[model samples]
Structure formats: C-alpha cells, structure tokens
Target: MISKISSQRTRCKSWLLGGLFCAVACVAQSQAAGVTWSSQYQDRLFDSGGGVLDTQFSFEVGIFLPGFTPTASNVDLWESNWRTLDRAYDPTPEDPNDGDPEGWNVPEQFFVGYYQIEAGGYSSSPDADPLYAFPGGAQAYLWVYDSKSLDAPREWALLTDGITADNLADAWVVPDADAGSLEWYLEDLDVVIYGGGNDLQGPGGYTLDPVVFSLQTHSVAVPVPEPGSALLVGLTLGLAALLRRRGLSAARG
Candidate 1:
C-alpha cells in the first residue's frame, strides 16, 4: 500500500508540472503572433496670410494582424477611411460649431489608402522626384478635396476612380492585408503635402492652409494570455495544494 501511494503522488506532481509548462508556452506563442499597425496624422493650419491659426486636426487608426509582420515587400494595396470617431478636430476661432471654417472642411472627410506606383511616379511637382521612395514600390496617401473649390468633390472623385463622399460610407471597412496585391507593408510611412499653399479663404474672409502635415506609422505587439490557459494553470496549482494537504492528513492518520 505504501509503494502504490508513493507512485500516485509522483504521477500527480508530474501532471501538475506539465500543466504549468503548457501555460507558459501559451503566453509565449501569443506574444510572438500578435501585432498591430498604427498610423497618425498631424497638421498645423495657417491663415492665407501665413499667420498660424488656432485650429488643428489630428487622427489615428490601428489595424490588427495575427501572425504577421509588416515588411516593404509584403504590404497590401487597399484604401479605406477610418471611423468618424478617429477624426480629431480642434475648435477654430473662425467657426465655433466646427473647428473647420465654412468652405474649408476638406480634412474632415479624407480617406487613407495605399497604392503601388513606379519609382518617381508621384512626385511633389511635375519636375520633382517621387515624394516617397519605398523599397517595395508602394506608397500611402491621404485623399482629400480642395477646400476652396466648389467642384472639388467631383474633381477628386474623377481622379480617384469615382470614389466620392456619397459612396464613402460603403468603403469604410477594415483592411485585409492578405486580400490585395501584396506590394508593401507598414515598415515605415512618410507623407508630405505639396502644391497647395495656405491661400484658401475660409469663413468670414479668413483664408487658411495646412502649413504642417505629418504622417507617422509604427507597429505594436499585444500579448494577452488566453483565458483557458490561465484557468488551467490555476486549477493545476489548486489540485497540487489539495493533494499535499491530503497526504499530510493521511500520514497523521
């Protein structure tokens, strides 16, 4: 009877140790497989006269990836706008209702998307080299209408293959990295606004332009242990403690 009891205790300890090891492995796997890509937009607005305005707008979005890492060659081609809540608008001195002044709300409804273009295809100007020269030949862009032009939406739609504000609601979907032509990934992102100057007239005859536009991208890893794994670890430890108490009671008996 003594030998049999000893063998049972050894088996129980071995099983408890195995359960602990499995719990640790689960946490390590989650850390290695989960990654999220994030993009941020920042801009400083100025009046047509080049005086810095009190208004500012900034936005950020995050895309989750399971078992994936962003690389220049693995980026996908896609376009979509983030949710309205992701858009940040500061109060402008000229317009109290919305930070943006009348006839100058272009940034309020811009789209964020990725496109693949030949090297130097999308230059700052007709004579300038490409604004972004990524190794994998892909670029990210923010598509917005001209704030001062009455026909800006139509012109923007025509340039972007019929994408307009009317149809933007349907295009607001989470991007699938594996669905499109894999040309590049979010290893790094840089966006520079060109051509348009801070000369557009805003409400009350106040002209405004984006004097500073900056885009930044980065990746974050989120590792959370699975609930099941945590429960299993807890149960194993509890059972080991119970067994020890029972063993001590048996010896006393």
Candidate 2:
C-alpha cells in the first residue's frame, strides 16, 4: 500500500509539470508567428541664434505582417502636426498660411514603411495602390534631403540599395556627394531615427539638421497570452502547490 501511494504521487507531479510546460509553450509560440515594422519621426525647429523653437512635430507608424492587409488590424498610425507654427502662420498678413520662414526649410524625409502601409489602404493617392508597383515592388525606400545642395530647389533623393526588412538596423549612407548616414532601430517598442551630415545649418547649429529626423525598425511582435491559456497556467500552478503540500502532509502522517 505504501509503494502504490508513492507511485501515484509521482504520476500526479509529472502530469502537472507537463501541463505547466505545455501552457507556457503555447504562449511563446503565438508570439513568434508574426513580425511588425514600425517607424517614427521627430522634427525640431530652432531660431537663427540657435535657440530651440517652440514648435516641434512627431509621427509614428506601425505595421504587422503575415498579410499586408490593413483590415487585419495590423496598421497603426498617428501624427502630431505643428499647431503653434500653423497658428502663427495663420495670423500672418502676407501668405498667412506659410508660417515657415525662409532658410528654415522643413527637410522632406520619407520612410518606405509608411508608404507600404499607406499604399496598402490608408492613403487615397492613386499611387497608393499596391498593384501600382506590380512586377517588382520595393522592399524599402527613403527620401532624404540633398546634403550637397542647400540652395533653392532643395533636392530630395530616393535610396534603395541595402534597405530592406532584414537590414533596417544598419546605417545606410545617403547617396550624395556628402555621403551622409542614417539608421533605424527599435527602442522602447517604437522605432527611433538617428543620423546627420546634411549641409543645411539651422538656428540649432551646423552639421546636424534638426528640422527632421526619422527611425524605422522591423521586429517580431510579442503577443499577449489568451485568457484561457493564462487561466490554465494559473490553475496548474495552484494544483501543483496543493499537490506538494498534500504529499508533505501524507509523509508526515
């Protein structure tokens, strides 16, 4: 009778341990099934004396994959426009809508992640059609201000080489005479941008263009465990604890 009871206790413990492992594994597998691509931009304005201006803007975009469908609740987007600057420009006597002062040109920057997601459904532009780039769609694209030309007709160039889902974290050199560099990576669950080398000098100082900077990254999305899975884990733990206590009590008896 004593040997039989011991074997029963061992079987119970083994079953509970196996249940706990399976529950945890289910949660891990759910999270590893998909990838997410994210991007963000921060634009800072400065006065001619290098004083930081009151107006700054930032925007963010997130895209989850498996299928590039927005209806899948895979795309998240938001932007903060220049409200103060827009208000300041609104009250101007001439070109009231044009608040941007000369030489403080808002550098044009674009990330392909935004374009791809928007082109998937969020954008109304005819070019937004995914099929528009049929036959050979781009893996990624970037538009950066021309560092060589700070004059009129500010040129923005499109870069493609070395830019892809797998290579987003790499510092990509801007194809220009100056060969400026930029990087995109994930931080705190968001993509952050860091780069410089544009010739245009704003009030903030030279060598760095604070007018606009962007970062992008692609990473696997971490999924939350289902309520049922969580409950199972909790119950398993409770049962294991109870079994442990009962076994101890039986041994003492």
Candidate 3:
C-alpha cells in the first residue's frame, strides 16, 4: 500500500512541474512574432545634401515575398533623402596641400530599386512611373574608404559594386583576430536603365537625375523560441531523477 501511494505522489509531482514549464514556454513564443519593426522617422527628418526636410521619411524591411515586385505604393520600406559627404572626395593627392573640393557632398542614403531608373535616360519619377524599369537590369555601386582612416584612400577612386540593399539586409561585420572592427560602408549604387552611355545623357541638355536608395541602419532578426524545447529539457532531467529514486525504493523493499 505504501509503495503504491509513493509512486502516485511521484507521478503527480512530475505532472505539476511539467505543466508549469509548459506555461512559461507559451509566454516566450507569444513575445517574439508579436513584436514588430519600427523606424525612428518621427525623430529625424530626411536631410538631402542641399537641405533637410520638415517631415520624416518612411521606410521598412521584412521577409521578402517570393517573386516580390516592388512598387511605389507596395514598397516594403522607404528611405529618407540622401546624405551628402561634406568633405572633398579626394582619395589621393600628389601634393599635401591639394585638398578635396569644399562643400562637395555625395548621396549616402536613399537607394532605388533594381529597375527604378534608366541608365542614360533622365528622371526617377516616383509618382508618374511607379516602378524603376531597367531594361537590361542594373548594378549597384558605392565609394568606400581605400584605407581604414577617414582622411583619404591611397588610390584615387575606389568603387564598390559589392554592397546592395538585399545584401545589406543580411549583412553583418564580425571582429577578427587582428583588426578590431572592419570598416563597413555603402558607396553610391547604380541602376542600369538603358545600356548605352548616350542613353544616359538625354536628348537635348537634360542631365539624368540619379536614382539613389538610402543606406538606412536596420535591426537584426531575432530567432523565435520553440515552446516545447525548454519544457522537454526540464522534464527529461526530472524523469531521470524519478527513475533513479524508484529503483532505490524497489531495492529497499
């Protein structure tokens, strides 16, 4: 009789502990997917090289849909105006005195989609033309620091065709053994409109407006926890202890 009662009590204790663990697991899963991404647009306005805007620019990034076609209205995210590099863009100079041009700013923020603009043609109209239609597709480019220091690059011009919006989304820089933090930068990206150089230069004298996309900083995706995982671990440990105790009890009997 005593053995049967003790066995029942052990089973009951295990059930109660397992139930409590499951409850805690349920709470963790709810928090992960429910949390949404948000941009701090309200705090800062889009600042173009020329000037800054009154209102904030809207933008977002999420799981890219399969065969996702980006439109102005259906834009998953938006970037603010471009930020111009204030200092002169002199990567290298023959003489020490020869400094970069003053008040020269390059567009850093505001990246355009793959087909947002034509290579040689003019105008990236967000309203009139919703999609950026590049006939032959386009290549994204940016100017990065030749050397680690911000002062200047040893080479004259260093173009970056590597970094893209899609790449940046999943991009991360890890600290290496030698160097502390490798420099991560996005130079200007190009969207190929028409193939030829003449097409880039419009009919009369109209200079094609650069279709630029912004390099906005974004948050990383967090892993969703499995509700049952923690509980399984706890239960496995408890079961092992219970089995050992049962064996001991039998031996005593």
TM values, all candidates: 0.25, 0.23, 0.24
Query: Which clashing pairs does model 2 show?
Result: 50-203, 193-214, 193-215
Error of 2 at 29 (Å): 6.7
Clash counts per candidate, in order, are 3, 3, 24
Predicted candidate 1, C-alpha RMSD: 27.0
* Local error of candidate 1 at residue 242 (angstroms): 92
Best by the lDDT measure = 1
Q: What is the C-alpha lDDT of each candidate?
A: 0.31, 0.30, 0.28
Residue-by-residue lDDT tens digits, candidate 2, 57-104: 222222212233221122121011101000011122244234443212
lDDT of candidate 1? Answer: 0.31
**How well is each residue in 112-152 modelled by candidate 3, as lDDT tens digits?**
21111223221133321323222222222221122222232
Q: Output the TM-score of candidate 3.
A: 0.24
Report the error of model 1 at residue 217, Å. 17
Number of residue pairs clashing in candidate 3, backbone atoms closer than 3 angstroms, sequence gap of 3 or more or interchain: 24
What stretches of model 3 exceed 4 Å from their correct place? 1-4, 7-11, 14-49, 71-253
